[model samples]
Target: MNLERLKQEFNSKKKSILGALASGTDASPKGSVDKQIIPIMELLNSCPDAVTTSSCSGRVSVFLEGRKQSSTTSAPKQEHGADVAAAGGKGGDGRWLFVTHDHLSDDILQEGQDDAIFLDMVFGGIPSEPAAPRLLGQLSSETRYIHFKFEPMILHVLTETLDVANRLLTCAISSSFRESGIVSPLKNPVVAIRTMGLAFDSPVGVYDPERNMIQRFIEPSGLKLLARLTNDRFRENSIRIDSFYRNLLSTMEAPETPLESKQTRALRKKVEGINKGRGIAATRENRVEIQDPLEDGIPFLEDDM
Candidate 1:
């Protein structure tokens, strides 16, 4: 019943994983392996394929060890000692193993079974897609554990994406933002999709590895900022969607406005600052700050990405 203990355990393990990856202690040469672990743990815990056996070589051995019992059963004992490395060794044939605390000590590992379940719920409960039908269902399930407002969380992710994309677009339109500034604002899509955790730069692409389809927004500007945002605009559309759900829990709670009206307002704002008829803001006194991460990164080049 102690939420604090559960939270502490989750935070500690999460930090440990992130630290291990960042420090190169637990990272794979391909990268994002650490990023993948949280979601994998979540999925397995959520809909566990009981005593599941999986192997890239087409056959796998399952290991179950814990506090309540002492046992070791190995079938196909010939490959019992298969190389279990986080990633490939120089031989380029390393197998991944998923181990739980069950095998260690009964008192500790038994107590940790609930922890694994909790971890599964936390990770598996993340909203991975912007357009999936199950997203609303997931949000409803998530509210049982965390105190987060679903509407805000939805906005947070969408706006974060939009902010990154917008920033990229802005940079592309102007010459102010640098190349390094173009680094991915959001990191791995899987973690964000699965756990709604803070996203960081991953060598991986925008979508989660488990999902083959591209996420909802495909615009170049949207990809860059899909992970970071500090404004309310990101959730504006989601808020409208939330309102239709009759959830009745709103922060800004603005009544839904027409899209044409919104676009007109935005265009008016742009034209108000135009130099003569050109719609570009030209304030010589206000120079763009290069260090501001929120600033757009898309270079104003003649060609588009």
Candidate 2:
């Protein structure tokens, strides 16, 4: 299709999708945009050349993997509440044991408690333990693993053209979202801003159906460490998001300048140092200051774009 025709179609679709989202008729599993990511979403949607199709403002979750269904077997229905589905998982059978988009506090991690009780406090349920023989028998069956994941912010934006997508991708990568890229460039170009390096995922335990118990692979201390690291990543993710938004707005305002210039590279390095907690001092001429959105509050106006 011609570029103009494509832009027309893209804009039409974007309008419909945004309308649905605003009216709470969004077809996404969550049925609405994440509260934390609304500013960025609004910014992108306000731009005439781009619009966000989907996004997540990062999350910490404990997911229970369900048994794989065969061609003959139907998928199991989910019995959990809306929060479980909102966390995002494999399928209907797989559910989130615990999930939160907000940062976790260290107070949630208590020491000296029974592993089961501690897990119950964190995951909202306590699985019953069975006899040794029964446990052994259940271990031989299909293993259902529970995973703890710290997912970073991810956003998908559809742009009017590849140039617009590339500009957004540049801003994303400069903000330390190395995984950001133009996912679809030939048709309606789509830019995905994300970084797997900020994400954390580990198998924390396994479920025993025979015993109706969850066997934790890590101790209380280990879990505490994981929580601490996840929180650290959460803070970094917020910083990166704020940086990306600022960079994108600047790029939009000054589209003539190349985003890969030396100044941009120097700024990216400073942002990287901040993300790593290095506190590296920037040069006098090329300094770039970054603030934590979770701490100092969002610096940008909601309708800045």
Candidate 3:
């Protein structure tokens, strides 16, 4: 690949990104694009083999998806609290009780609600969604929610070489964990990094107002701790991402191992980090220590994923 040509192309694209950012047209409901990675993005774009097309630092959201709603197409969360119920059914899509880039505070649980409250989505710069109180599934009026999407920082890099892409992906995976990220190869050649969070692809079982006993197992303090931990993990993931690209730029190289080798390395690194606090081997002889936290009294060991 022509390094100089790549740099020129990156510069052009970077210019457009900066222009759009300056014009305040990112269209993200949470806020303007994150300022944390702009410098890192600039540095990467200056390099010959990389250009960023889009990026997000991360976000935490509380939303309820309608039966027909697709995960990728859900509406933005409500910013104004007072109108959450009245406006809920108004929106054609799902509802968001809370959405933010920063970690939620302890007072989050204190947000008051009334009979089927709907959030207000009319405010400028706030993502707008039609009100729909029916979208939420809750049996008890007393129970609250701790749902969140702790997406870590994600980025799209247009690159020119397999070597560079593989190296970035390798380090990024190890740094963020295996499932946290992936690299997309394209005619334009893009490196897409997706970081993970506590929230899975789907919601936990919906509250059944008609039958299921309200799961009193959820504690406010525990939920708050979970939120805090998830938020902290999200930030930690972002830092890892930063370290990946920044180290690549400075060193101008990454390990040239096979994909699986890189994957194993990253996995081992993750296990090592986790086991720093306690000893539980996740690979080789002690691999079973990970898959099954406890063994039966029978003392039989089996392979599992």
Candidate 4:
């Protein structure tokens, strides 16, 4: 393959994307790119052998799960779309509820007054004693809080060579996002790296858009803390991601490779002589020492007999 030509093609497209981004015409989803992450993007795309396909720096969000969208409802729908949340578009498949890059708000939860019809329908017309306290109490088991997600940003990359792919994977795992980074499948032609971490799955609230009922059992202060903590974790992960890529670029460009063993060198030298056009890597003289692609990270193509 003409590797240099392929890289040139990648660069051309990369340039167009960057131009769009700088001119505020980037087609990438809102929230997918933030100013804080621009440095990492530029750092990666600047590499002669690497290109960033997509990336994010992570964010905090508040979401309420509503009943399945009815084909009949004419209300506007908000989505997982960050811009939707920002625009206060509350009707999506379910609204994104709330989203932010920084822990900018101390008030994340909205105060909800009790709903009479909901209490009667689900609680037999008996309000829990002392309406002043215990917002929804055990009715949380009935018409209650659901789950909210706390997610970190993720990034994907394409490297010009398999060796660079493997090295990037190694660097990612060695860094803080160990469980986060994953190598692409052998069939894939590109390398992908991402950041993954804990997400809270506890049911916090629920919404019945049809009934216009929303009941939250958690305190407003608690929600504020959750948002703050989410931002904290996201910022930390962002730093780690930046460091991982910087370290990868610097160390990879000028790697300190270990000296190969004499026996290993001789074996590779012998194998290099074989015509790789055949799946077999050895001749009759070296029949006992053919290398396997899976073991050595080499790709094995099917024979074209």
Q: What does the lDDT read for residue 184 in candidate 4? A: 43
Q: What overall lDDT goes with each candidate model? A: 0.25, 0.68, 0.48, 0.49
Which ranges of candidate 4 are over 4 A from the true structure?
A: 1-16, 28-32, 66-92, 105-146, 180-188, 252-305
Candidate number with the higher lDDT (3 or 4): 4
Q: Write the per-residue lDDT of candidate 4 for residues 151-256, one digit (tens) a residue.
A: 6655666665554554555555445554333244332235444444544545555654355555555554454455566766766776786777566555545534
Report the candidate with higher lDDT, 1 versus 3. 3
lDDT of each residue in 48-117, candidate 3, tens digit only? 6666667777666655432232234335533333333332222333456556666555444333522112
Report, for all candidates in order, the number of backbone clashes. Answer: 21, 0, 20, 9
Name the candidate that leads on TM-score.
Answer: 2
Residues 33-113 of candidate 1 have per-residue lDDT tens digits of: 322123323332232111101101011111111111112435454244343212112111321222211112323223324
Off by over 4 Å in 3: 1-15, 67-92, 106-146, 180-186, 197-219, 252-305
**Ranking of all candidate structures by their TM-score, best first:** 2, 4, 3, 1
**Candidate 2 local lDDT, 1-305, one digit each (tens):** 89889988898989887887778785555666678788888888888878887788988888887664333433343333332222334553677788888787656665664656556755548463322544445553245677888999988888888666655665777788876656556777877777778887898777764666777776667877788789999999999989887876676566455333444555545544453452344344356455444442211112111
> Could you arrange the candidates by lDDT from highest to lowest?
2, 4, 3, 1
Off by over 4 Å in 1: 1-113, 120-259, 266-268, 271-305
**lDDT-best of 1 and 4:** 4
Which candidate has the highest lDDT of all?
Answer: 2
Error of 4 at 292 (Å): 23
TM-score of each: 0.18, 0.72, 0.51, 0.57
